[model samples]
Target: MPSSVTWGLLLLAGLCCLAPATLDEDAIQSASHKFMLNLADTAFSLYHQLVGPSNTTNIFFSPVSIATAFAMLSLGAEGTTRTELLEGLHLYWKEVPEAAIYTGLLNLLHTINEPDSEPWLITGNILFANLSVKFKDEFLKYVWELRHSDVFCLRFRDAKARSKVNDFIEMKIQEQDLDLFEEFDKDTTLVLVDYIVFEGLLEVKFEAETYVSEAFHVDKKTMKRIFMFRRSGQFELLHDEALSSWVLLQHYRGLGPTFLILPDAGKMQHLEAEVSQEHLTRIFHSMAARSASVYLPKVYISGTYDLKATLGGMGITKVFNDGAELSGISEGQPLKLSKALHEARLIIDEIVMDRSGARPSGKHRSNLLTVKFNRPFLVILMDKNFNIPLFLGKMVKPW
Candidate 1:
């Protein structure tokens, strides 16, 4: 565990070395083959916690079935036959659609909290980076083949059609816009990149250029509510001083909240506005404290370039120093910083999967009958220690 900045720097260094080999078009296919193998290995370990060592025979069945069932089992699904049979089914399906292999696997495994028991030391040096680059290129080739060519796409697309009934059930979350979800439901089988979870909160960050800029243009207030599920379940009114605009909103769970490192007041001019380092330190301390409460609850985390415990149970763990000194805050400002931090925590608590909903957050829906596949026997997770993007990319259930 390191500071977010520390991990960012490490990942950057790793990327620089890996860039060259991946850039070459010829090397991609081989890279993907290797990447998938590694991904499967990691996924297996992750599901071990969710579906015990003795039970994990196949990567897609038993464990997946359990997780998809929302941690409970129906009468017929209780015995070893049901578990092992499901495991065998997943193993059969594992080799068919290759591009989806990595992402699907990761989501399945992560849902089970696979730990990195066998930590692979990723030396971000030239040689190691080049090796990763080679695999990354191959992985990209497999991904492209599935996405672009109609032949593979059509066959898998139908196979996926058979799979979506279960896929949709796993991805359905609370507070989701029913209208939008309904519209997409008919076609909600796995796509190249349908979002499942957004780290820990209701926020989503699409890949660069994934959608046209014009495709999304909500006001700041709405934008905040839309992505601040972990921060606040309720909506808010925000004033966009920069554009002299105002708007209304709604938020979701598991997405990170909006944190303003520096405030921007475009229109209303203030002569000398500043938050001294002392105040900043106090704010940081408050956050750190909330993060360290005795009752460690699940919270969503934002930002792209950091290594969270790739696999483990949910809770907060401090990294780096126990404490640091504060420098510039005036006496009154300390109390103000404390208040801000508390507000932020309260906002976050509101959106976590709690008893606030009539239906329990992580449990399956029973009132409305729906078809679900033999519990995904095992989850297939990706190993992105060498390539960070692959890890993050595969973390969600993408349909």
Candidate 2:
């Protein structure tokens, strides 16, 4: 009943389990491989059900899940088989509504390798450089500015007011890239809107003013003020109460089309983890326009443990403060659950290393582990590299 003894027993069981795995032709059909197969089936099934078959909405799907799934399939299938499975997934990708998802999947596919009767480890580099050309072309553009303008308006009859108007026009021009936008004159009665872009088809709007929130500043006791100025340094009017403050600009630049002002690249990083429906819209729009790479990294680990006792003969202690329940189990529920728990622990601890390319593009990778637990539970998301969380609950709940 000591924890150390339990760990020793678990380690013995794991070694025994691994001993029978040979590289023979029938190796894949062994009982040890069932968990991986089930993982693949369940993961793809969940994705299919939740995401449907639309390329448009595909980018919104979790990048972690997509990359991990391919990595898992790569481990189990060979050259032709791997190609078939990858192509099969591509077939499904075509139905994705979100183009970024399509591109991102392609990025994921480039990370996997076919089994060669030896361990298949993917290096996570995308070989198809040309595959991104179209996406890139769609993102950047060139255009001619037919005319330029500046705000000559006056407020409170002060130089600062006049200066503010100038700053506004400059920021707007860069933010919106309008063919025609400027302040009329120093005596003009009109006030300028901060930063915004509006075309017949595309429109991006930002707050007229920035907030000086105590929480937002490094010095909580003080506030920070951010003013929207045109690229030319002209000032715009103020907006202090807006919830969202970033937008995009689109137009034609001579023979090629161009994207005007983009959301701050820093702000864009926040969008990567957002799973809302609206987040998908922005993600695809950016993907189509800029062809930016969204880098995602997933880590997992492996080890064996004994449920009843550790290798040092100490009794197993509950990992958390909450009391554990171990009433009745039909078979080896504790051992199986323990394995799942160990792998889960490895993932949460970031024990695995990320092996994607040097470029920060949305490249992702994962590690797999065979483990046994000192508790009872079911293994979820292992097939998908357990990138996504298995349960949904409070932000911080009982582990």
Candidate 3:
């Protein structure tokens, strides 16, 4: 079994928060799409900064989760701190009112996380504050009503407080064990955590017998043995001349399709350097459905990341320092973000044969072409309608 990779988004103190007020559904959707695009751009930019060109490690994180947490934290931000957060998130205060943005985010979250929604997705937010700190009634009310997050009070210095926080995270994610925090000191005042979990089954299940241990080329000189899933069908394929990459779209039962980008041999670095949300938007819009045989590895990635440096690099400073202003949250006791921690686990596996044991027929045998991801590739899980990235990652070395 390959070791699971952990992806984390940690924002230490003074971020943003979101909520829903009164707004038209259509207008809210439109506004939310715009917001998601900007957020996606910021997410990709942060990812690139965290995983520089020299690293070959597998990368994964939920942009929506991190953005949701920031949106919530933004509620308490004021002055230049607030401006930096809004600009950093690609939010133009002049164009869209802050209330509308919050409303849009809430509607978007509700739509994606609806109980009956396909491709099971779970998203949640929580805030743990020191017991001594008195959060303002307005801030608490908005966080609960708009963001749908729960607030808990904990003694930061308690030895058992760390275990309690960890327990809450585990329960929320349905995982048995998770160490969300190692230690809490006197300086630790507030902790904010967000998570997103997706379990998607391919619309067309892959046959179990076709699975095989294949050689996955980590690079030109290195290869690792990994299990790969094989299937042949009509798919939306694009040979992006601009990016010098082959883009493939694989549909899940519900929600948006997963995009897999395979750059030409030895061109991964160049593509990564040039890739952006605008470029991806063009490629996805240009894709046309065609018959092809697709081979992708069975991927399971679990990653943990500290996003302090990444957020700071993106010009979101001041929030971590003592001069930070979060008066909207508390009355008098000055509070700065003490810690931001995020942990996520994602498993991408093919759905086994049904009870009838049906197999793929020779439906598209006439124009069958082969497209295999035998090397490092990039994956983006997104909402088809809004083009919002639920999860973004790069698979370099599977292990």
Candidate 4:
């Protein structure tokens, strides 16, 4: 179909960097680590935007996916547009120059996606341009050099285009639940689709048989029943006085701890206001190993965001407007980002991840050190080594 929209640069933002060759390995690693930290902070801020004071909304997203996607788009952006984009990503404040951030992101992504890395986690981007629009060879070359991925310019003849794309994603995710067709509009000429699949393996398993129906608090008065998975073992636990929330760290074999924060009754607002990067870092450092019987719901939560407004809020408005300078993408045509869509799905399964890594917790042992995520809770999946959040989630009710 003929459309005004054209091609897009939807590569992972940090997948490649416009880097100078003078830096040593140490410098690159340091820059990448700092970039990840800043990205984590952006994750928290974006989460806060989706979820307000109530903390009653369920949200799941790959902050890295969103950050890198924008980074890719920034390659084509110029003038104030590029500046605003970097600022939104907190790419400016990290002491490292913007080049370093991109360079570091390249290393960071490469390290995490090494061949030895487990299959449970996957993230990739595909930039699709309809056959009619001509993209710059230099742009594609730069993208290929950086992302090490191919961009396809296909003939969008029918719905099959959507089906083909969805099939690729489903195969990668190993699940067919999400439908990406709904996310795209007919006017979209150039599209960049990003996805993340994370199947977290628990270092210690919660027996599936122990799962029992329990009350999950949606609010003070509203409650719902959920098949809560029960386990009792040594876990890193903490009580944050600042947020008045009981923070529990459940370690996933190699993925790191999924921080489950359950706010005290009517304390959700306070938790939202007080939560920050420093606070979370301090909390992680202070957490001590304690034996407790923990309960968590099997949650299937997904978040779909139209990020134009969100990015605009962060001073990235010029790229979406008419005066956008995307000549870096296409020479003769003026490219405008008609839509910026992000979709993330997170499933906290009740069943043990795999046969080898985990064993069922035989039965629930009665103990004073007990914690139940029966209320609205926050789930932050982070990489302990990099201090980066892989998936940030809030489960108001798990079904």
What is the number of backbone collisions in each predicted candidate, taken in the order shown? 36, 63, 22, 2
TM-score of each: 0.19, 0.18, 0.84, 0.83
Q: List the residue pairs that clash in candidate 4.
A: 6-190, 13-68
Query: Which stretches of model 1 miss by more than 4 angstroms?
Result: 1-190, 196-258, 267-347, 350-399
Q: Provide the lDDT at 213 for model 2.
A: 17
Q: Poorest 10 consecutive residues of model 1 by lDDT?
A: 336-345
Q: For candidate 1, write residues 260-366 as lDDT tens digits.
A: 22122232112012222233223323342111001111232211111123111212111101211111111111110000000000112332333334431323323
> Candidate 4: what lDDT?
0.69
**lDDT by residue for model 2 over 136-248, one digit each (tens)?**
11111100000111223234245454345444443443423322222233323222121211111112221112212111121224333332111111112111111121222
Best by TM-score: 3
Q: Please report the candidate that would top lDDT against the real structure.
A: 3
- Over 4 Å off, model 3: 1-33, 353-368
Worst 10 residues of 3 by lDDT: 2-11
Superposed Cα deviation of residue 59, candidate 1 (Å):
35
Ranking by lDDT: 3, 4, 2, 1
